[model samples]
Each structure stands twice: as C-alpha cells, then as structure tokens.
Target: MTQPSDVLYYSHNLNPRVAVAVARHLRAPLRYVRADPMGREREAFRPINPNTRVPILVEPSLTLWETDAIAMRLAARFDPDFWPPARREEVMLWVSWSAHHFTSAGGVLYFEHIIVPRYLDRAPDHAATAAAEADFRTFAAILDEALAGRRWLVGDAPTYADFRVASALPFAEAARLPLEPFAHIRRWHAQLEEFDAWREPFAGLD
Candidate 1:
C-alpha cells in the first residue's frame, strides 16, 4: 500500500502525542504544522478547525479535528491491530471517555505545570490545580480499578484505546497529576512506554 505523504498534522498548543503514535504505527510520514497558541498561528488554524485545537489531521480527501476520530480513520486504513472491527465499539468507548474525562483533567495539570511555566511564562494556578487534582483522582481510580489485572485497555494486544488513554500519562510526573495512588495505571503506562511509538511520541519536534 502507498503511504500518504501529503498528510499535514497540525499540533502546537495541545499535545499531539497520540497522533504521532498512530502515524508511527501506520509508518506514514507526517508533515507537521506547528501552531503557536499565543501568536497568530491559532487564528490561522481557525479556518482548518473552528475549535482552534491542535492535533488536526489534514489530507487531500479529509480533514479531521478530533484526535480519536483521526486515530479511528488512520487505523481503519493502515493498522488493524489498533482498530479491529470486532472491537470498534469498545475502542470508541474508551476513546470517548478519555476525551471527556481523562484528558480534560490531565490537561489542567499539564497546562498548569508545563504549558504555563514553559510556554506562557506564567505561574501555575493553585485553584485550578486543586480542582483538577480532585477530578484527576476520581478518573484515575476508575481507570486503575479497570486495569487491575489487565495489561491493555480493550483487548489482549495494545489498541487505539490504549494509546488514547495513555497519551496524557507521559506528563504524569511533570504535571503532578496525582497518579501516585494509581499503581495499575502506572504499570500500564510503563508497558506502553516499551513501544517505540509511545516512548518517542514527540521525537522530531525539537
């Protein structure tokens, strides 16, 4: 099969690690378009995605703004291990849950600890962090219980669901995401790090 070379991946303000992992799994080369959250770059991206979010996938035939949707589309075409037909519903459930709950909470800590200090040159918001911490723990506990003896999120093998959920965990320590109580999640994330794609999701960004 011919890999798509004209694919442009826009990511800057928000993390695109999951998209990077999917690209790696597909062995597709992505032309990255970095958007600056604080500059005119975000405005420029509005036409592409009215939500003005990064990690937007643009190709000749399609434009995908949501990360889970992009993962599903790419996996449907390129990688079966990530998106088997029989497991499609389960995969979507986890992906949706990650976006609605997990990532929302994790984004708070990531923005406070990393994005604010590193990019925005500002102090972390204590009130926001406190609220996010509570939310993080609530979701983390649910995930940890689900992962009690399971190594993967959906099936025996690692799938898009695993990638979607674990995407935010790379910043766990740096973001102080209140993960110390979730051993199962930590173990699962460690297993994900064993994959080359997961380990270096942001490889060429420098």
Candidate 2:
C-alpha cells in the first residue's frame, strides 16, 4: 500500500518525537522540516505556525499543532485500532493528562538537564531541577498506580495515548527523570522501547 506523503513535520528540537512515532506506526511518509526555534528558521516558519514551535503537522487539509492532536489526527486517518471509537474518551484522557501533567513535569528536567547544556551551552539550574524532580515524582506516582496491572495506557493494547505519554521517556536517562521508584512505568516504558518508532524515532532524518 502506498501511504500518503502529505504530512509535513516541522521541529526545531526533538518536540516532534510523538508525531514521528505516530507516523512510523501508521506506515506514513512524513516530510520533516527542521527549524531552529531561536534562529532565522523560526521567522521562516511563522506563517506556518505562529507559535514558532516544533512538531507541527501540515496536511493538505489542515495544519495541526500540539503533539496530542497530531497523534489523534494521524491515528484517525491511518490506524483505527489505535483510536478505536469505544475507547476514544479513555485514550483522550491519557493524552490530555500526558500533555498537561506528565510532560509539564518531565519537560522541565529535560530542558534543564539535556536541552540547555546541549543547545545553549549553559549549566543546569539546580533549583529548577530540584523543583522539577519533586513535580515529576508526584505525577510519576499517579502514572505508576494507573499502570499497576495494565500493559498499556488506555486499553489492552498500545495506542496513541501510550506513544503520547511515553514520548519524553527516551530522554529520561539523559535528563535524569527519576523513574527508579515507578517500577510499572519503567516496565511499560521498556516495552515501548521495543517499537522501532520509539527506539529510533529520528532514523531517516538529518
């Protein structure tokens, strides 16, 4: 089957991680446009997305920003199993929680620990790291309890919700996300790593 090649992904940093996973899972051909958020590339991309952030999905019909929305749109179009109607609400719940809560906590550590040092050539803010660690633990506990006996996030199988939530985990080790205490999260994330999309999300990109 020839998948559509209309999806154009724009990302400066690794913000398009979940979108990449969704596209790969759908067997879709995504055109990646790398743009620096703080450079001239941002100015060039302003007409595309005024937010000037990465992970924007541009299709012939619509321009989608926000990782959760992009994941849902791709799932709806290409993979029904990942976005079954009966479990739509449950899947959305996890997606929303992940974007608003999980990533909120984890993104801080990732930015301070990995992004700042790598991109800006600066040291991590210890106070920010400490606060982020505390926030991460609070949210990680909730996630651990949810995954007590489940293999995936929303249903019996992996869905867009799983990909959305686990997106930041690839940098967990490097960012020091403090996942040691959440055995279930660790186990679940380990399972996510088995997927080619999660393992090498940027495989074909420059």
Best by TM-score: 2
Indicate the TM-score of model 1: 0.87
Clashes of each: 0, 0
TM-score of each: 0.87, 0.91
RMSDs, each prediction? 2.7, 2.3
Model 2 lDDT tens row, 27-127:
77667766564467778778877887777888887888877777777788888888878999988888788778887789899899888988786789999
lDDT of each: 0.79, 0.81
State the lDDT of candidate 1 residue by residue for 1-206, as single tens digits: 77655554556334566787777767666666566433567677788788777677888877887777788878877777788899899988898898889888998998899889987757899999999889889999999999997889998999988888876788788888888888999899989888887787556763
Off by over 4 Å in 1: 1-4, 12-14, 42-44
Model 2 stretches with alpha carbons more than 4 Å out:
1-5, 12-14
lDDT of 2 at 155: 75
